[model samples]
Target chain A: METFADSLDTPSVVVDLDLVRANIRRFQAYADANGFKVRPHIKTHKLPLIADMQIAAGAIGITCQKVSEAEAMVAGSSAITDVLITYNIVGAEKLARLAALARKVRLSVVADSADVVDGLSRTFAGEASPLRVLVECDTGANRCGVASPEDAAALARRIAVAPGLAFGGLMTYPPAGGEAAVQDFMSKAKALIEAEGLTVPVITSGGTPTMMHAAEAPVVTEYRPGTYVYNDRSLVMRGACGWDDCALTVLATVVSVPAANRAIIDAGSKALTSDLLGLTGYGHVLGRDDLAIDQLSEEHGRLVSTGPIGLKVGDRLRIVPNHACVVTNMVDEVYLIEAGQPAPRKVPVAARGRIR
Target chain B: METFADSLDTPSVVVDLDLVRANIRRFQAYADANGFKVRPHIKTHKLPLIADMQIAAGAIGITCQKVSEAEAMVAGSSAITDVLITYNIVGAEKLARLAALARKVRLSVVADSADVVDGLSRTFAGEASPLRVLVECDTGANRCGVASPEDAAALARRIAVAPGLAFGGLMTYPPAGGEAAVQDFMSKAKALIEAEGLTVPVITSGGTPTMMHAAEAPVVTEYRPGTYVYNDRSLVMRGACGWDDCALTVLATVVSVPAANRAIIDAGSKALTSDLLGLTGYGHVLGRDDLAIDQLSEEHGRLVSTGPIGLKVGDRLRIVPNHACVVTNMVDEVYLIEAGQPAPRKVPVAARGRIR
Candidate 1:
């Protein structure tokens, strides 16, 4: 008998719009009740359709990592007018692109150094509107931020006086489970900036692992969580969401059952991605947790079990990948099972390959 | 001061055409002297230009892991005719695509089960020409293959009698440093199939790690290597290629120097992939191995050192990623540094996101 999923090619990403809607509503409610604004990061889904859904569900804005992504998102959707790119963007070519993107959306960016500030000021010096620049704080994440709150204040002061730049506020991708650090660092930075006679408009903090505890950092005026809309095994392992809450899964087919304990699926690192994120296996096989996805080549996934891996050839399985963000970036089109739609609709990943 | 590399956006892949030509010429010469057919796998560069260079250097067609990759490679280049898809083309959608691809070129695929053969037979039962099918054998890779030589012979016989299928040969993605096993298993399988009055015309073995020792397995007729065109840190560590021979390098700009020991680059997992490949760092920073690419978020790569990290914001660095194949798939366009040209040329990654 023909099935609803037959239209989708195997090793393709399948995102349930119902789960996405529920996830967006749940997180939006949590953020609203907690007195924090939700700015869903489009890096996880990389789709303008879901960004529109998040906005429809009362999200304040969307977050993008690159100017190209912001351009693609704003061009693809009619609702996403605000975008915050949380990175220290350097170089002239990207700065011009950033200036062009700033003209389209209410743009804000993060910076941790004088070089990035000067570069931005150089590009946007003569623009009609000043660029909103945020001071990125460490907050114990140690990825891209200033070392201390003093450095954050210093950067904030630099941005406030830079040509064609306005000191927006503070931003940090805080360490997972480090709400106290976020509260401590951001509060200190806000105090320092206030003492400098500058008003910190919006303090932004991002990360899916600490979205629930975002209220702990009361100074954080906005919450940016990318992965909650399409939670994966990493988020589930951290108790951020349940298995049923996962919106994105790789739809694969069993092409080889070579042994009693081994079965091979058509999906591999190319489809599922190689982002382990401290997970033992590649993904959580939906209904087959007993089976471990042991290894992945570019085009083959090895599923092994202690006993008979009861899977046969042509059997289909859905894998919630290790990192949903990276998985979505691997494919061109994702199969969407939207609410009220009987069949899966294929949607192109609009912001894919916008790494620059 | 402005430089020639200024035209390139930060976190962009740069492929040196000079090095690619040299690498392809060197490998093709080695294969010629060893009397083995070099069917260069296009997964690493994913560019038809490089594929054309490989063919000009006397490669026997190209190797693609998916139907879409094959389609992109064939469509982009004018000099390609033969293609080999080293994967079990499963499901009706892909089978139909595979059938369509076969009509345009000399196409062949590998399978390890009767089910895969049946799927192909059902799709191409009444085609004008029978599809070429190779029995995938297990030479200790333990990923996707029939278990033993006897199983290989049985599958070969199954394909021999299947309608609209011709038993072409045998293929295996053997384990690294397992040339003896490839010789032992493939020889035994060939003898068994020949005893059954079936001709095993071509015996294919693939893997970049064991490409140099491919001739130890005298029964192998073709050697497929994907990573030789652009050697990465993994290949350099394995003594396969030197650092200077690496054709592809991620051109990134230092966005933050957070501390004396920490710096951050614009490239992250979205630019440089998270494929560790058992390496200590995400990539090898050109001329600065002292800095370890400690961590990667979506758009930030943290570089840490034990002592004073002299890097400043706005400084440019090129990284030879841990795995070049995965890195090429992360972006849509790459900067090409041709030999005669003074500046870099932008080229779209034509076969990127061809996972399906």
Candidate 2:
């Protein structure tokens, strides 16, 4: 009766807030020990409650990817003063929004070019205050940012002299190649930016895969790792975090035991997002690695198990999704479970669907 | 400002309701000519307005994938009197919910076993009315359902005799390879069910791909195609609909022209829902087919083109996401465009985050 196993309601997202708090503490401790500032990315959790917890755990600030996400967080807590938007702010309207946000908090953003620099300059010109800007370096991701240190330095110089703008430093998302390359690139960029007579004080770089190694690298002044708070199947596959370290789990109900080897859960792609991301399957069933959640309908998760899982109809199972960040955006609320508790505290995912 | 090209927001879901209406009319016309009831699945749009439009245009009822979706739709309108859930109803809790839903509307569900039948029977035995059930056949998408026609017929027989249960008919999600085989099996199963003196009224079969072909197939009395209303990149790839027929698009801003050939948009896995389903990339840029949206960060979409796209800062583009259903789940509201206009009537995706 206490379990949600008997419920037939499909396409709902379930969260364990207790696990989220533990994750926050763990990541905070890691950052504290490494002498790097912890700036938890709100892009992963998207909940204001989770963001508050991260800040409460002694995080320097929150890292947001969108202006809307930043706006949502600002609405939740004016106390969260320092926020770094880890995305390129281009376009007139977006820069205007960014400029407005900058007026409220200690706002900083990443950029990769002169056009982006010009866009920000035009939007923030003649303002009483200015927006902090970081020149994004490619760092082998080959996706965004300047490919070379020279390009980064060139942008940094423009940012240093641009009206209503301050050059914060350099930023990059290292592609799983590791710390040596990122450190090398950051060092060259920092030297180049300083050579251009601008202070590159805040060097930021860290992804879930590079978190452990990022602490060992000295050039990065701040590390922002989001997924360490919710170690998913993808993070586990990459050896980023242990299964025990995974704090977020999708609670689902077994709605059908159609075949001896096959069972179906009410939670599907709609609940646990079908983002396999090169993984073998949709998600990993907690405590049952042998069971494969092989197929996902939008509302029904097709679970196939060769072993005796002793799973029956109406049994509630917790699933660790392949990617947790995308899953956070799909729901409006989440539950925070305290230790040894029957009921978790209900908290609204206030920023859940702020996709703009 | 008239064209969607001038929108201010990035990663926005733009639906051409005109195209959606046209698709609905086309499907309704096909179903009317072919003598099959059109039960348009609400899983595609997750919009009650669209579902109501389909019903107004001659849909007999509607198909809901999730209990929450069905509950929301039923709550929204009194005109939608009948709903057929195209999923297995399992577990005591879900059965009770299903029973409660049956009280308000003529509810029908699909199942593949005696356990589910027994669960439904037990839950609805004392109710004023009985629950209608359909035995799901493993037509082609070997994801779920009974493997043999004999098993399906036996399950149907059990539903007929069980208290508070009525055997409706057979249902199948037609996979590409086994349409003919499924037709042969369903024909035999229909005969077997009829021989048992049971009313097998609703023989439902068809997905978006085989929807047209299913109408001509033997023993398919109803067609339930979800994605025809909003043709996606995947559907276009399958040749079910052309690019012009695509009703759904994700409007995004070009956030970064990082390199000459590569640009990054503010939309990524969060906006596009990383449900690749074996397509080459996340989405197809409206005017640039050669530009492949090959990489996705949580909030950044990396577009790779052979040459410079002539894209600059402040440029907005519409992208047809690889999958529309998953995209709908990511946003709180969507704009209903008449002719791809920037200022379109905004429609709330009412059940946007109703996962469970």
Candidate 3:
């Protein structure tokens, strides 16, 4: 069988356009059926074309992690008008950039404290439009968010009255299996914010693992799922997706087979990324599930099998990395495999490395 | 007590040129004393300016992992004329690119099998200059290279008689603390190749943890050390270098203080990378030894402490990541901290994502 790995150069990310569209539609259909607006996060593919596909498929808007990433997405695709940055925007430089980005798109950001809110207010206080700021709540993940529902309410009130800012809603990157906890925390926060006479327009939560049960959190108006567009090994292991649903795979060529059961591929941390996500191996080798990606240096990944490995130099393998989001950020561009196409189209990951 | 994080943007890699110069000189002095040439691997910093600095500091050449990276390094700096790609180059597109690169600079590559040797020969068969090919020996690293010294000599002979290939030498990415194994394998391989009447002018070995003992293998003529330019937590923990010798640090701003002992920083896997390198935490927070970077999301790092974490929102901290080489590849550019300069200079990592 002619595979994507056969034609492409080694150590390149190949996105099946067919799979991406199917994924976008599947999530959109689920959100539509469950009464939630889908704001596909560009953090997965980082390609404006993919963002355009999401928007065209009926996404409410897009989500980005950084101000520069938002700016790059906005610059690359005119279809993206609404952006919600789900991180606390800090620093005068980033706040200024956020203000500048607000002019191009309908920009909304999140904050859990007055320091982040004050910084955003300072930059946009004199702008033509008020910036929408969401109060991030800690349902359970504990990475970033307000401590309690009362704290979330307080921050919401603070954002509602802050100059050149409006209270958008509550957002949380909740635990994988904590939809009930998310609902409990967000409902209380929403009720309290409403009790204070503040309108919470949106309650957003996301994680591919808990996506199917997202309707359990009835208070959440929007769902921002990134990796669903390019489901990876972590999502697959979580039962969020299967091998057939993975849109992106790292195409790598075997470089050496020094032992009976051991071979090395050109893809490593630099190509596949080192995001283990609690898995034992780095990634799942497509069609070669018996082989374990035992070790990875910077530019080489070691594959070992229980038997003779059955591999040779120049043999290509498609790898579904443990996490798709970080792998997308490792390359400058990715190849898109399409149906009935002679060659895979090259698409630049426009927002790649926009971490600042 | 002004820190490197005080003056620059958050989530940026800051390199102290002074410390880099010291590291270069220290390693060069050791290599010079031991009668070996230093070939600095650009895989660590990926900056042409750093490559130039290494060349000026007495590096005989530069080591790159991919053909496109070598092309970018040569394009960005005129000083990098001698290039050695340590990874096996496969596929036609890359081979064509490599052949084109050899036309401009003195280029060499490594191979452990006849498939690779024949590919290199086919690419350079009619060129005016033959491509220098090295036989990679597996000195127990098990990542790549021929199985044994006999296999190394066999590949060396294959390259020596190839249409337009010159047998450069033997190369190995040896296991840490296995200098004696490297010495035994390389000496035997050298003797075997010499008995076959082929000139083996160079024998290269590298690994940051065993860098100090590289000369322990007296037959090794050149040492290719990548991480020595920017010693990281791994090196510091392994006794390869001290904390003061570290040149690169990730400057991050605390964005969320969700609990008394848990704080979150803006830098995550995207900025600092997820390379554990057998360590417990993601990185070593400068001057904050009590804190542990327990978890990393795509955009958030969770820092926890046994006691109440003193870090507040908007506070800056310098983090020495677990693996400096992978961390450097995460960002598009890094800020150079200079001694007398008023502001840190922004240097583009020209070869950051040239994985192919």
Candidate 4:
């Protein structure tokens, strides 16, 4: 029955702003200690306000996976100087958007094919400035990017000769390894590109799980790890961060006491999201390891207790989502809570649902 | 390699201006045929644009589960004259939003306890109009609402005399059963209120799954169903509607040809969403029941095939989501596709992610 005009109702996203600041500083310091440039991935926290804080705290640039996310971030923060678009810029419409962004800021994007390079070339042919391009090599992750060093070099050569494209460097997202595979992949890619008498300035490689390993990789100059700032359930399960390091949580209220051992919360898939990454359930209840959210309806979350849940009717609980990236796209706004505060400062999740 | 726009993305939330119109007409016709007033729930498609279409097709008003959704429906549609908020307005902040919305439109909400009624009374005590309230009697969903008829009547009496509140009538969301439990519960609640010399004029009950059988319930005078517009897998699996009657589908592209039998797609939880309602895998591949979306990453959908899937790289396919309501909140726009047309009109998902 408490009314804080800013305190959102049940099934709302709550962001810990103080924790986010600490996470940013920790990652930034880690990157500095290892002689790697921190291009903190903006895909984790799409809000421009948070991006401003990260950039101000000594992030070399920001990395965005979608053009819409990059567009939203730049529109909100004109102060951000460097932005590395870490996705393949395919299709004419997206290439045109990328070219326009090049005129606005120091923009760079990655591609793994010659056809994509040609598309970017034609789109930026008459633009005021050229778009920076990087050939994405597949060290592992196997989702996108070229397979071998030969393919990466071929793409780099195409970018060098394209009408309005400048070859920036080589980039690869290796799987979880102790820097050996990343260093080998980067060394081979750099050698192949330099064999064509082209200098690869920036070699980017990093994921949240292998950020520390990638930072220690001698061949990589820049790193792009997204979920490290807002550690999620997947990150905790992967031993990247502890539960206390997670900055984002879904606040839900117990709406139903179906049974003595079972209760349903108001937060469902619409709030907690349905991105379970091989995890047991949708999310983990904060401060309660004994309990698990068993099932989720569109508007109801069924939670089963191991012991006594220690929860009653109308009780509020914070849940760390399975994956924070997908959770960010499920709401319009999120409340920012300072450390050790019951009341949170209202902050608009400005780019919450920009999934284009 | 097709592109929509910066604002309008393809494979987005499409409000079939025509199908939505037809759906509204059909649901309203059903309500009229059954002698029930239609208060169409807007939670399924959280858009004021579609709410206006429902009103144009003779909806009594609109039903929203969130105050944020109600605010959007009121702001977007002038024809939505009355708004019944279906969820419990718990906190002070949401109560203020609900009371403020009451000033703009004919607002009604549900409550099951004196504490909630007292909260509403405290917010709008000196307002021009008393807050319209309905007792949410739990039929069988076991999510929220009062348990028994006596509990319903007690809350009704408290609201009838409560300051700045009016006892409207009784509302129960009967589960999947027809008249098994809901009919009896509502009848007893009506008798109790009538014995107290009070008229239970508005005995509303209905959900998408129970709407068909709801018409025959003698105690129910009105119906409120949301997902009837776009029936999902749950509805179809329940034998509610045929596959042809379902309106929504997610269009995705095969981005990776990893193996002969396995492939990856660009659309993942971030795109199609992973709201699997006890169904196997994430969603159903249209026209290919054998092909299952076995797993989903943040932006990668791992599709498993029985025999090569006969799908080539760069091929686009439509996927029927497990649940349509959660998918609506994950995008900003939707494409209204024709039966055989190459292009579709871009309809803005006006109220996407309006979760407060």
DockQ of each: 0.79, 0.63, 0.79, 0.34
After the best TM-score superposition of candidate 2, give how far the Cα of residue A255 lies from its true spot, in angstroms: 2.2
DockQ of predicted model 4: 0.34
Prediction 2 TM-score vs. true: 0.95
lDDT leaderboard ranking: 3, 1, 2, 4
Candidate that would win on lDDT: 3
lDDT of 1 by residue, B1-356 (tens): 12446777788899888888988888788789989899999999999999999999999899999999999999999788999898888887888889898999999999999999999999889899999999888888888889899999999999999999999999998989889999999999999999999999899988887688888888899999899898899999988988999889998888889888998888999888888888887999988868899899878899999899999998889898999999998888888887668788888989987877
Task: Sort the candidates on TM-score, descending order.
Answer: 3, 1, 2, 4
Worst 10 residues of 2 chain A by lDDT: A1-10
DockQ of 3: 0.79
Tens-place lDDT per residue, model 2, A45-144, is 7777777788889998999877888998988985689999988776656777888888899999988888888778888887888788998888888877
Model 4, A208: alpha-carbon shift in Å? 1.5
Instruction: Tell me the lDDT of model 4 at A179.
Output: 77
lDDT of 3 by residue, B1-356 (tens): 24455667778889999999999999999999999999999999999999999999999889999998999999999999999999888889999999999999999999988999998899899899999999988888888889888899889988989999999999988889878998899999999999988889899988778788878899899999999999999999988888888999998999999899999999999988888888898999989889999999878999999999998889998899999999889888899987887778888889988888
> Lowest summed-lDDT stretch of 10 residues in model 3 chain B?
B1-10
Q: What's model 1's lDDT at A206?
A: 83
The 10-residue segment of model 4 chain B with minimum total lDDT is B1-10
lDDT of 3: 0.90
Candidate 3, which CAPRI tier? medium
Off by over 4 Å in 2: A1-22, A307-310, B339-342
